[model samples]
Target: MELSHEYLTENREYKDYKDFVANCKLTKPENFNFAYDIVDRYAELAPEKRALVWIDDFDDEKIFTFTDISRESKRAAAWLKSKGIKKGDTVMLVLRRRYEWWILMPALHRIGAIVIPATDQLLQSDFEYRTNAADVKMIISYDNPHVQTEIEKAKVNSPSVQYLVTVGPDREGWVSFHGEYEKCEADFPRPEGEEKTYNDDPMLLYFTSGTSGYPKMVLQDFTYPIGHIMTAKYWHGVVDDGLHLTIAETGWAKSTWGKLYGQWICGTALFVYDMNMLKPDKMLQMIAKYGLTTFCAPPTVYRFLVRQDLSKYDLSLCQRFSTAGEALNGEVFNKWFEKTGKKIYEGYGQTESTIICGNFKDYSEIRPGSMGLPNPLYDVEVLDPDGKPVPRGEIGELCIHVEKERPIGLLMGYHKNKELTDAAFEGGVYHTGDNVTQDEDGYVWFVGRKDDIIKSSGYRISPFEVESVLQKHPAVMECAVTGVEDPKRGMAVKASIVLSQDYVDRDPKEMEVEISTFARENTAMYKVPRIYEFLKELPKTISGKIRRIAIREKDNKKEDK
Candidate 1:
């Protein structure tokens, strides 16, 4: 039986999306710890059930069962306790796609430690800020030379960090995680009384991608995993006893969304491909080789996959597909569906919440660019500035109703910043800071962020619509659309484009005209970019999200000059 059944209603299967919304219910336990309740329970029930299937670019493999996970996590818990790591302590893990990440995550949960999974691409300044802000007690990271040097530099000023552990070869001062943990006995037991974790106790912390300002810490309590039952079982469509893969590095929140909690609870073995670099061909080859049954990735990944000669790959084994992290372009979705005979279910979410809306399996009609229906877990709405719901088919800010009670999956406010928290949760709702519209069918369409919308001559333009049209053009590879200051109009729609490799040598002026023409023909004339600039690459956050705010800031500086 699927472990998710323990948290969900007795009628686990639903007739349709509406049936799901009405019948699906989550039973939240008072002292629910995922490590003890889910992982260990699976270990006891089916000890040999495959839990993880880890592989690397070099063709190395590591497979673990529920028993292995249970035993190793206990050993890891022992090793951590030996280092004085205890309940409520913040421990950052910068192990990107390393199998050790799988071990440490549950171990930290077992000890009631708050785990902050960070990207390996962070430099000294990023490390310094995060460590100080979270008051991190320990850090266990993969041994990348640059990351090692930066962490060492940051440690000088980050007095909160007491222990440094490395997953790779032994460094001078860093403790070897595998070396020490393997020697420890797996005898750590669940804590009793106040030492135990509760439903409301914080379990995870994720630093937002800081598109506008400094990254705010988003914290989730123990009940967070309970919310993702909808994400894994419905949205991603992970089949029980199948191998599921979500293409994401361990550092980001996407890992948790698909890689950990819900997938395990659904009895699906996780397939982790630790690729040092993302090559489309290799990714397809891995999927075919492993026969992964379910898959989820960002729209950017699908955009690249669609560009590949997909006919050469056998993706028949991977049945379900979904995407998030950024808005999905209609062209990309159509192309992918055409090639694979499957629709890519688009989901919308943030570091602060689980899947807010998604094209769930067996229900959603799979609108190409729509963000699908709102998840039944929260009262999702498109609201005006005063908190009233806007009429259907009108644009407004996407907000979640929290007037009566905060939902399970939503974050426990920004860590240590009550001012920002209160501002966000004011008016009895959690403002998503994203602007969108809902059709009569209740499918939500992403316009842009509150700041990302481009206004010109009394017309509001969605950068996403413009970018979707541009993406359909052959010359375009990736693009960021933003509003630039204009003397005539308050803000002009500007597009920064990275040309496709095939069109790299094309004439810039001619290519711009072709792309602009394509956009004008497909979308409203006002939505087309007034200014176009071609570049080799667009500025991006470490997680590979295009930084439109960075483009807007550069344009603002130019206007000031």
Candidate 2:
């Protein structure tokens, strides 16, 4: 089944990518609840149209039509409302890529409640921090033992979370999600008058994996999805009646950037793979198994993919491939191109915004490592320290100017943190905190992050947090953490340590393993250091500052054995 929706609302016509960016306009409706405006509309128009095709490790499959989604979400909404959940309340979802997430998220939007999508990998302390920070009222989670145990333990500190709803099988003190959904009424009526959601209503809340401090809460209005028209239609090269697979967790912002909004609006069937772990061979098999048409993932996935025997699978069904979350490495792009005869297109954006820059198909030529031109919907520029546009070939921060108006689909601001929100949106511009350089040809090359943040396996990590954990050891005097170049992870966290006098004489190999274990126990798996270097002293600049850049430069220049 195919659906028809124009790529643009205001400027509904464009000849090329250049024309789209220069003359783009958005038509924001007064009360634009995506759940009713898009999802239900699809159900009314094309009830039997496939919205999602889901698969799991057990080879269990589920396909949902627009009518099914519309029905299930209404029931889910009625069930949630009966639990005393109201508009403006925050509900956290840790469904772990389960099919239930698609239904439950729309349910929250229908009720005008703020939906917080969280990863299943979070520990007890992570649960405590996020729950308390957002004043989360209820938590709907997967039935995994680890998740249940962690939340049960975290509740002692999170007094505000009043409800615990578990999906898949009953737990002792939790509501069975499926049982309740089956019993709840399928008719959910819209709120009347002022109680109804508006275009500027905060519908989505995302916790950004910050590079330096604790994760910040990103608040997005209901119209955020409207900005991704270019992302799917032009940048990702998605077509109507096509199958699109974006390799991202349900928690991360990238999922919505590719999975939900733009793809559905373009009438493409979304593909979801619920994997216990990421395996390149298994993923390649799925592409052939399902005959996926368009695919997108982080560069790390491609790095591992290129190392596999791709000749065994038939990938001709795929018409386009894209990479985001980080810059595409030239080697991986070249290797994949040579093997599969497909060029990996690159795009750029952050948690606070949708696709800011991308090599939009039909507009710009693909430059292996460059982020394509700014999307016409956003006024993006490479600004130097003074906040002025930088000359070509010069490095600058990627900033989005909101002088005309706050771009549709951009985050409203950091929730409950006016200081941070003001600082980022200072001068009527949103700073992306990423550095890049552009050539005269208008292609932007990513230089690095302006702060000490690590991009590994598509997760943004804080160097400060990892270094703080390393310093907790009694045997450590001082330590510095930086990202080391890696083909698989984009960059691996490397720690150079100065052991205390008593621990200096200890066996180096034995100490290495001990420290590694210590790091794993104290920090998240993604933030743990992979490479350890024992140093008598860390390199310091004239101002007595640790030269972390020196460490990164040294690692980049190191010849692989």
Candidate 3:
């Protein structure tokens, strides 16, 4: 089927991208399952089409056809059912980029269970919270002793967890997932009347990064996969039957953004790189080795990639580049563009929704730092404090208009927290809690989080602007900007910085002086950080977002002491 531009606007209230976004028509179906509608449908039509291309750090490689994935996932579904997993049961998957994540996810969908993709980097406390909050029934994890040890400790506090299934080598007291699958029939029958699942049935639950407090569960229904059609096909420009690589562990929401749902729905081969550690040079080498066609990663990864010389490897095969998770600075964006002649198309979305704003393929005009236009499918708008629409070019809260009803891509509300959900939609619009400004031409530029915006001496400042300036400095490697409590100014701009390794041996006071001087010259004097803390590393959430709240809290505690 040839996808038309109308597919992006099908059943939507808005005529085109120009209408002041309001009352979007959300698409719903009687029985909607991505595995059936997208994946399995493609499998039936093109059984031998390449579905996934996987490679590990050790250079091991494998390619799975749609038929292979369909068959293996059926066996996995049977195996999971035998282990007592059922509909609505939550299963935590801690496989980092393993091909098994692909098999197991579809398997969970086939069995009508909820899959919670989690990172193996979780500490015991993190594990405890997620397990308790979600009432996780089983944990399917890698056999790494370090992660296994944390799971063992978390089990003591999580009584609802009934099984530990290991993906790799056998671990004591843990069931071998591979071994169990080997015994199961490859052609297992689907559950009785399984085809009757509605579009609203919960298929996945993602725990927010918890930068503020304990993570909130974000539940997405079966139709969530349909929403990502714009994500991979339009925004990422994924090519059919070509490999697309998104640098994310299987745990994070970015995996869904790039790996399984959208890419498979587009008939593109998903690339999985199971690496033990992130080495920018090694990753580039792998891209060359595997002939990666399209790539997406966070700004953090791009920061590291730009530092390495580009002439050392062949990136000619890569056709499209995209970024999300956090704001991308103009410096890194320009550098990558200079090297590869490929502009990194910035996209904006949250754990709560699919790609809401992005630089689409048809939009040839690339703004260096803009987050592009609001996605055609979503009724997005910039609103002021009173929930009124703000004038164009004015900064305001980013909100999704859900007057017709929440879209399929949007979360079903904070799981079990109606109060929070109501608060989020109190103004009749789904407030994203992010502050941004729309240009006269309609491109949305990220300012900062509403809470992260610094109010100093009656002036509002975006931390991202300061961080963007700081990133241009040669001595700086990474930085997080936050507001520190100030009696005179209400709040003072503070920068917690990590210097490059070459500058580590330099005197701390001297390094601070250099950074402050660079900031003063590069940006407005009032925007420059008044207080600076040189650190070995900035605190980050599991998904790699710098936790400015943690830094603010630590600063506050020190003052109290």
Candidate 4:
């Protein structure tokens, strides 16, 4: 399959990319399964092709061929079925990038079960909510004692949960997944009923990072894998038959974005680094040691990488780099571009969708801060609250045109929440709840989320813009800006900040004055944070996203007292 020049061009409008994106004329098969179509098909065509390369903190490494994956998944499917797992059964996975997760995911798909990926960082409360809300039946997790304790506590409340399966080591009460897999037949046939599933059958469920309330379940169908062909091939510039590493745990959606579906579909060998904890230098060393060709990570990781000396590592093999979790700061972008000639291609999406916006590989013009344009298959726009199109350079809610039909990559709906789903499309647009401004040149720049916006003294302020400015300060390591209640100004901009180790003991009041003065100098005075609180670290979600809501709640409680 030749790459489409039209779909790969940068700065092109949706119309230009649309012609080529949907032109391939691959008809949707009635009972399509990714494990069957993409993985097994590739295994049949190229049996010896390397599909996965994995290493752990203990320097243990293993390589899996396409044939190996296909065979193991069959065994896993047989084992799961023998345990009474069936079609549409919800199985929660908390395997943190273990090699077994790679096999289990496809096996679940082969059985037509919905795979819910969760991080091991989940606390007892998080497990209780997700297990009950999703009616999860079985849990397959790593043999970590902390996670085991949480699962045991949550099991009392999660009535739907019936089985506890542990990988790696045996727990007293839990079933040993590794032991069961060894005993299962390797050539067990795929269930006959799997042939009845269509392209629209729900295959994956992801819980949104609960920054506001309980996390909403975002469901994606089997067709979701088809959507990421662009993500792996173009956005990440994944080279066929080369090693690609994306730094993310299995619990996050990014794992699928880089590790599983798209990379294999593109014929690239996925690289997994299963570490107990992240060490920037150790990660750099792994890249050099493994000869990794393409790399992708969140902006927060890049920020830390920039602080380290680039010359210490031999990163010549790394040709492509990409970022997603949050918008890339211009400072990190420029520094990385300077160190490596390769530009960091920034893509945008949520747990609800695939890569919807990106700076593609074929594009020559790379904007430092723009999130590129809307993906070709998606009819995206920036609309005001009234559903009217906002003019260029004006901030508005980012929406996709649902009247035309939701794209293949989009979530089916907020699972089991019709009110939220209907509200999302009530105005004839799929509201992203994110604010953005498109430039005259057609690149979109992210503004703060609608709720994250601060209204102080009649002026609306974007927390991202303010936070970006604060990040540029030498003293600041990380920060989250939120609106706090204020009688005088409706809402006040409050910054909860973590200073660099060098500045930790320094007087916070003095640092606050400096940050305030710096913001006033760089941006409008109204946008400057009215109050600053210094901390050793900002509270973050399990996925490593800073939780502004937690800070806001703390401030509100303080004000009430």
Q: Point to the candidate with the largest lDDT.
A: 1
Q: Give all candidates' CA lDDT scores.
A: 0.90, 0.83, 0.85, 0.84
Q: lDDT tens digits, residues 1-561, model 2?
A: 332244355434467766776666667667878788778988998888889999999999999998899899999999999998989999999987899999998899999999999888788998999999999999999989898899989988999999999998999999899988789888987777766998888999998876445789999998888777778877888877788999877878888898888888778889999999888899999999899999999865776687689899899999999988755656567879999999998898877888888988756678777788887778878898888899998878888898788988788999999999998988879998888888998887776678656889998775655766776675766677899878899989999998867789999888899999999998899999999999998775321235677777777678454
**What is the overall TM-score of model 3 with all chains considered together?**
0.95
Please give the clash total of every predicted structure, in order: 0, 2, 0, 0
Candidate 1's residue-wise lDDT over 1-561, tens digit each?
A: 578888876545778878878877788988888889888998999988999999888889999998899999999999999999999999999999999898899999999999999999999999999999999999999989899999999999999999899999999889999899999999889998877888899999999886877899999999999888889988999988899999899888999999999899888999999999889899999889899999998988888889999989888988898899889988898888788888898998888999999998877578889999989888998999888889999999999999899998999999999999999898999999999999998999999888888889899888888889889997888999999988899999899999988999999999888888888888887788989999889998776788899999898899889
Residues 211-254 of candidate 4 have per-residue lDDT tens digits of 88888999999888777877887689888788999999999998
Model 1 clash count equals 0
Among these predicted structures, which one has the highest TM-score? 1
Candidate 3 wrong stretches, greater than 4 Å: 1-28, 190-195
Q: List where candidate 4 sits over 4 angstroms from the true fold.
A: 1-27, 193-195
Alpha carbon lDDT at 489, candidate 1: 90
lDDT score, candidate 2: 0.83
- Candidate 1, position 542, lDDT: 71
- Model 3: lDDT of residue 471: 91
